[model samples]
Target: MTAHSDSPPSSSSRRRTAKKKRSSTPSTKEGMPSRSPRALSTSLESIQINPRTPKTPRSNDRRWPREDDVDEVELSLLGEDERRQAADGMGLEEEMDYVSQPPKKSVSSKDKSAIVLLVILYLIQGFPLGLALGSVPFLLREHLSYSQLAIFSLASYPYSLKLLWSPIVDSYFFRSIGRRKSWILPMQLVIGTVMLLISFRAEEYMNHPAEHIYEISLAFTGLVTFSATQDIAVDGWALTLLSEENLSYASTCQTIGLNTGFFASFTVFLAFNSESFAHKWGIPRLTLGTYLQFCSLFSFGVTIWLLFKKEDKETSEEDINIKTVYKTMWNICKLKHVQILCLMHLLAKIAWAANDAATQLKMVEKGLGREDLAIAVLIDFPFQILGGYVAGRWSRGDKPLRPWMIAFGPRLVLALVATLTVFWFPKPPITIAFFAFLVIQTVLSSFAGTIQFGGIASFHTRISDPVVGGTYMTLLATFTNLGGTWPRFFVLKGVDAFSIATCNIKAAGQQLSVKAAECVSEHGKQACKDLGGECITERDGYYIVSAICMGVGTLLVVFYLIPTARKLQALPASKWRVYT
Candidate 1:
């Protein structure tokens, strides 16, 4: 458990307990004090955050990572005096690598092949993301209810949760082939295989998505899971592929490649698939199946190409263990600031939940063209980059949250504007003025999201403890991503709950079955439409839910959230540290 207590024992009491516990604890063969296995077990239990049920075992081990089990972060943290003690106590005079990282290869920045390889792999990774986050949701909105879309949204969860198992992927790789390859090759192959198989019935599943929602979600979830793993491996391998001199290229490649792939799969694919666009160009519509098969082929080709590519193995021979990583993460979580920050991340998205989850779909429902929607996104990309860059610059000072808070106000305004836009949308044969307005709205929304994310992310990077390395930031990010994810289901459900609709506008004499469906349920809506009823919904639940989100969010931010965020930012450096 997290070992939290508003009335925790005083420093004197804790020191006395530690002294007593150490005296009671047994000595190792080298005469170093060893923690009980029970303490480790307790730390393991803490991973699930049962803070109220904390075990009261206050030894030095609880205060810091012990000598023998210390990880890379703690290893580097050893001072001259501490290093001598650690070296003498652990008998580590000979193995220097255990105490330090190995030197990185100094590859040139002009290493074209390596850059190309990284770009291609990242591009492959982006396809599944686009398919899940971009392509699928839009398509489903046309035929399914918000409730059904909520179910389908589960496919996006694995990306957020990937960090939980990342250490296992990091540590347990087949040395024969290579650590990165053991993960990347298998993951890519599996992702390709899944995509290839799904291609067989892509159109069928999409056309009657409600009937196969579960199956579709499962398949895509698997794809995303594998892709997430692949991403971790690729990211880790990027260090090995590029020398310190050229390491900057890796992130550039990742950005360019992933964006290009996601753009092609989502915006380009949708534009080409639009009947209006295709007919205007005198071109045949692209099939979903063809796109899936093409993506699978790209995946397969990438796997094959990587099979021959060599990687520089890390000089440190010791492997990372999953248990150790989880324990480290749990210890970080046990911190009061970390816990509060995590909770903040989880609750932060509430104000914009409806805007994020329902806005584009609402646009689609409100007579916006898929092509036009794709175009809006297409135009928004540059602004996203610009927003992030500008926010990144602004977040350099003491208070990053100021930028984040500023962005939130505009985002909330956009949320309200989004709801109004949906309400005021003109019927089919959509006007250019409306389309231009929607496009402008989308661009601004994208910019707002970028700035908020960038500013908060800068804050996370600044405050995160180096003792845990990337794991600390990764933990925060997982919760941040999760905050946006889980509430979607409820927000979607709320859409139907808060709406007022009537499906009783039936043909003159076909009134026998008008009562079968009041247009509430998906099946009922279909049934109502089949009975020749207009199924008119005078008051959309989307508007009610959005208004509630904006009001609650604005109040929460002004009266509570912004102040709480400043307090968190003002916390002393000591509180952020999880280890001594």
Candidate 2:
């Protein structure tokens, strides 16, 4: 009886020990528990033993796939000391990769499309400038004096002052259509309509330009004002449209497009109006009015196209008030670079101003016809385009504004050479040699000017903060325009100051028998008689003006630009902000 009772208790204790062993031995399924208290305890213990095995290794492998994979293979072959050394090597490689690898550029298709649109919009911005500024010298040469034409420059005042209201454009925008489009579309339409209205009366004005000079000036001034407003919007849109990498080309588009539009308005328009060419080609004669209407139609068509397009909503939606605009403007003005840039703008283009104002008049005075002027300008257009493209490419890489100082030397040299041409070239009935000389000079100088302008424009685009793009760019452009415009005032005054008096005998009605030449005088001044209605003036003023301007520009470049460029090179690129 004692033996039977001992066997039963021992068998029961053995069964209990087997159950405990089964629970202690880890099974794959023990980690995955199902609704049992004993299984839950086993799962908890299993998790504690290999806590990092499940997740930490997998994440590390994924994070550093190549390094980790190589590490695992090497670790298996290595002893503990070797494995530790290999791990240290792997960490060093990872750090080097992190330091050396360039950040991936993520340019999208949308960004490309936006750049194309910017090119077109910039073209449109350039379209009216040809008529307003480019064609003014040629068109007014018949009826107005050089002084009168220079005074007409007052019309461009809006371009400089547009910055005053640029804050308004930035702060308030049409949310429905887009911040840029709302202003761009309406202003474009207005400019087109104004051009059309002026076209209806353009012939009348042309026939009697003297009588309608003030009226024409007033009318064109309104057009320029509207166009300047449109420019503000377009500039702001460009800031939002392009990525930082693509900003270098912004001025390339501006230079090419603007020159193309100017060529059409100035050179092509003059060609169409050429009496000799019109007679030869048998093309139907069109008045200036018709051309204006055509431009207006084009403007309207572009406006319609803009309606179908969409812009990115990258602009900040901060509650923009007048006070905010003022504060931002103030802050922008306070930047050290901004102050220097303003002074540069005021002086940089003085040489260009003298050349631009005096070149056409000099060519005309040298007996070149309107058709000759047109052909010269046409030949110049392609070179300008080429220069802009080359400069844009040079500026696009790691180096940006440094190329401007290099281009400055060539630009100044060309201006000086062109000034000398005025004195050396003979008057009307010019030889083919003279014409060739003029063409070559025009081509070379246009190229250099375009390059210089492109660099300045790219720099402006780079520095402008996107949040206040319109105000910022417009401010820079305004200074540039002011530099270009103010010199004209001095140039025009100098033209009159240096003019030599010539007497007209035919108008005086002096008899052949008279003892002395009866010179005609009007209002206590000798009446100067020359071909093409307006009396020809000597180019002495132009030479002096160009020399002085070029000298000052050279001095500034050496003293200001060289130092500034070196300083800019030393600074980190991150210090130059594109967006606020």
Which RMSD does model 1 reach against the true structure? 10.9
Write model 1 residue lDDT over 301-389, tens digit each, in one string: 88898778876544331222456667878888899888888888777778888988888788777677889888888887777667757
**Candidate 2, residue 444: lDDT:** 76
Best by lDDT: 1
Global lDDT of each candidate: 0.69, 0.58
lDDT by residue (tens digit), candidate 2, 388-475: 5676676654456666768777777777777777777786778888888889988877676555555655665555553344446545
- Candidate 2 minimal-lDDT segment of 10 residues: 41-50
The root-mean-square deviation over C-alpha atoms between each candidate and the true structure, in angstroms, is 10.9, 22.9
Clashing pairs in 1: 1-46
Cand. 2 Cα-lDDT: 0.58
